[model samples]
Target chain A: MKLLESVGRIVAISRKEIRQLRRDRLTFGMVVAIPIVQLVLFGYAINEDVRHLRAAAVDYANTQNSRLLLADAHASQVIDLVRKASSAEELEEWLRRGEIRVGIVIPADYERRLEDRKRHGRSARPLAQILVDASDPATYGSVAGLLNLPPPERPGIQPPRWRYGSAISGVSNPPPTFEARPFYNPERRSAVHIVPGLVGVILTMTMVLFTSVAIVRERERGSLELLITTPMKPVELMVGKILPYVLIGLIQVGLVLGVGALIFRVPLRATPQDTIVAALVFITASLTLGLLISTIAKTQFQAFQLTFFSFLPQMLLSGFMFPFDAMPRPAQWIAELMPLTHFLRVIRGILLRGARVVEMRHEIWPLAVFALVMLTLAAGRFRKRLD
Target chain B: MSESAEQVIRSQGLTRRFGSLVAVDHVDLEVPKASVYGFLGPNGSGKTTTIRMLCGLLEPSEGKAQVLGLEVPKEAEGLRRRVGYMTQRFSLFEDLSVFENLDFLGEIHSLKASHRRSRIDTLLERYRLADRRKQRAGTLSGGQKQRLALAAAVLHEPELLFLDEPTSAVDPENRRDFWESIFQLADEGTTVLCSTHYMEEAERCHLLAILDHGKLVANGTPQQLMDDVDATVVEIQTEDPRRVREQLAGMTGLLSLAQLGNRLRLLLHREVENPVWQVEEELDIDAGATVQVVRPNLEDVFVVVTRDEVS
Candidate 1:
């Protein structure tokens, strides 16, 4: 009978929460909107594969060989030859003015330099040099790999030199110098990496922001005082408060992953069962975080500020915006403590790497532990009185 | 009604301190079962604090409380199901419909579905909220909201109800209606401990406890408090009432002086002899004032009690 009573109380609170959620149209919209809007924004707009950078050419050679090399540069689709500079200085001026991202300065002895490099093999001066702007991140997620187009292949000059890559610092090597072939997503599409990690971002943002205000709103409106005077247990209130949002969290997962597969063509490499399990663990962790925030914050506005404060670090360090391995060791340690960091790896591993849940167990355990600890803290912090 | 009737709530030297400020100083209580007991005090007089300690929502700093034969703050979980608390602020889920609010409480009290429905139906009818059952609680008028709050508080059929200023927002007509509902609950054997700053409301209680600076200065029926007052109740009527007010304003032998239209009612401290004659001599009115030694009521009782120092 006591167990039945507990179940009844939990159901009552969950039902009340659902009714309130439906009534609040603005908050209700966030559950569906956060996933779709963020997916389309990050998936389509934020890209790593850059193309057709505005470029200028300073062909001092002014010969058949230089013209053929310019044609090859345009053909690679990495640079568009917009302006023809009279000198290398003019090309440098265009690059600094931001009118152009890449500049091709073919030397005056282009043909002679090519033959000289062919004769000298590794020791000769390069025939061409491509200068690129590497200051901004948009430019930095770059044209580095694609700009290495071979300098106009010749028929008679057996294996001509003048490779002229980034290592044009006088030291030269044989052809095919350190080419990068992408694995998993060989096309290097941003959507493939972004669409999966978006599930974590949207869940973290909405779930934490949503539940953190759950108790605080009650406290503000005075309903929590009335609620505490009832027979409902503290743990029962905590569980019931999160139960409805948990369903919302699950529906969000289906919407995000399904839309990802349909629009972005992000592949589902692992079993759906594994993905669902990971999503449930992550959803619990995020909800517990929100519940804890609700207990700490005195008002709904504070909950919002705290939610955004937590979200920034996870978005930046969870291998979402930057590669996780590239961060400094101390930053990586901070990232490891965030539940999103572990969930990001587990979700990305399952979705992109085709790894099974067993293989990702090391990452998933942290998520479970985080949920348990936060749940305990939230339950402990929620008092039944105004004090 | 009998001498051997039980006490549903009892406390001895109940104290609550928040930092250095004692919100509820040492207070003793004996609330008879099935009585409409009133807590009378001004704002910050610790009526709410004392109620919270008895309801187990707050822990007493210096003493112990027993409600429904259960020790508070330790057996608070057990006490929760048996007691109903209506806070000063309207604490119902305002976004929820009136019926839904009662339904939620019914569930929390672990009522079976059929019993819950029947109990809710009875409360809606009793509180005259049957017509506005579908209205959101936030949109309800002040009186209608209080009615719904009372209905929700009693939905579980608790043996005790803690109402903290339940009628503050209510109109006189609705407040009268609210009292009728309280009396009905008392008839059904639900002991009510209601707190209020309004003297008119306090007078309606079957028994009363007047708090002053976190201490219980007086506890008894309204008549007992009036008869046991430590001052003389004198009413002075004159044409120039302001002159009378100024004359008796700072008299050491006066406990409290209040103006009711043209009459200056004073609770004169028993330190002086023939209080009524003394007030008549002080008036010195050109229109000639009449001094009548009248019977003291709850308002005079409140003034006399609140001015006393904590013992």
Candidate 2:
């Protein structure tokens, strides 16, 4: 009976807390506005896949074969023929300046060498070099794959070799040429992985940070003393305090999901309802954790410090950026413990793979566990009397 | 001090300690039912700590306490339902309006919605806060906030009320108004235990306990305490009271000498020796000084009880 009374009292206090929060404009914006803004920006604007790799060609050979190869290079999807550099020096300049990612150099003796190789049955190959810029390793991977092709034809007699370099060798050496396929990011763009991760980070950081500071700030200002002296219990106080932030978190999820669909063309891998449920679970856990931290912290500054430390490990361990499958067994196990890690999977899965709620159960358990532990610890820490 | 069956509060050897500091020493206290009992003390005298123990908000480190006829700390939860506590600091939600603060407090006590409105209305009218019903608690002045805090504390109509310096920062007029409301509660047969430093307010109390340095030095009605320390407090009007104070420094059993405006009031241990004559004769100070004995007030009694001067 007493516990019921305590719980009832806490609820009343929590309602009062929400009323106070609504009155403060800055706090309202931080809790409600920022989450939605972050969601949209992350979901729509950050593309990770590579679309245009700048390429140039120097057609010195001028044979029909050379023209055919040039036509093939032009027709290829990976490379964009942005400029025609007539000489090696111009090609080198373009590569250095980063105007083109891939540059082609066709040798001057290309037609003569091909006719000679056909008559004598001994080939002297014309030198064709593919020079690629190696910055941004992901975009350069596709640009580098273009070199695995047949070697240029040679003259009938041993051709005069120049100090320019050894003529391209291994011609007609019959092995399948490299056929590149990207994993996780087939388009090889930056935004696909980044936007989802950004949404998680922003929601976690802002929601937890703000909610953690709320109670501690009241305590510092002498209002907590006033609150505890009344009939309110701790649980009601926590729930009432977290409700607004949870709503804001939902709004943020919607923005990020919408932007990902409309702008980045990032698809929803699951039903909207499933995504909403997962988001609600994730937000509840986050709010619970924040309230728990607030109970232990004496001041707003301490709350922030606790929140910062809490999020640092999650950011590093959650496989938002790095692949968890490749990590060590223990590290991967730890990653599964983080609520964000599970939610990130659920969010990306639904948006990317159209996974159902049943398929996302693995993610749901961690959030549920997180909520239970946090709520219990926070309730245990809050005392009714002033010390 | 032990009381009869009707006593609402009783304590024996009640004490509380924080680190090396003894905030409340072993002391016995008894408060009769339906009476206004004032715990009078200076700052750091442990009035707050004692009240917390009585309200079941704190466990006394050593001792036994009974509040509202239930053993404290052990029966704190049960006693909590019967007592309303208003702390020194105003604890209502700042963003919430006066009505909301009262409503929230009422809800915490699980008052039925049907009964809540009438109780709130009574409290609002009683505190004269009905006109400012919609104003946020934080926006109210210090006195108004204190009034609101008191109103909220009493919303459930607990049998006993504990007020810890509830009007410390309030203006004089508000303080007077607060005391009137307190007296009204006492008339309604509710026991009230309040802590305060204002001696004038102490005079208005039916009973007072004067605590100093964590020990109860004097406990009785204001008149009884004054009568116990029967002494003459003479106010002497002079141009140079400090000079007069120096002249009368160690002469015969003079208890205390304090300068008031343009006069030095000499609190004599007794008028039997006629020391005033000796002082007037010694300095030829009869012309400028006004020498007349007056009845000792509570201020004088306070000095006599607490002051430990050598001479």
Best candidate (score: lDDT)? 1
Q: Per-prediction TM-score, please?
A: 0.82, 0.77
> For residues B101-220, what per-residue lDDT tens digits would candidate 2 score against the true structure?
888878877887779999999888888899989999889999889889889888888889999998898999999999999999999999998999999999888888988777887889
**In candidate 2, how many Å is residue A360 off?**
3.6
- Candidate 2 segments whose C-alpha is farther than 4 A from its true place: A1-11, A36-185, A321-337, B1-3, B230-232, B270-283, B308-311
* Candidate 1 chain B: 10-residue stretch with minimal lDDT: B302-311
How high a TM-score does candidate 2 get? 0.77
lDDT against true structure, model 1? 0.83
Worst 10 residues of 1 chain A by lDDT: A174-183
Across the candidates, what are chain A's individual TM-scores? 0.68, 0.61
Please give the DockQ score of every candidate, comma-separated. 0.63, 0.39
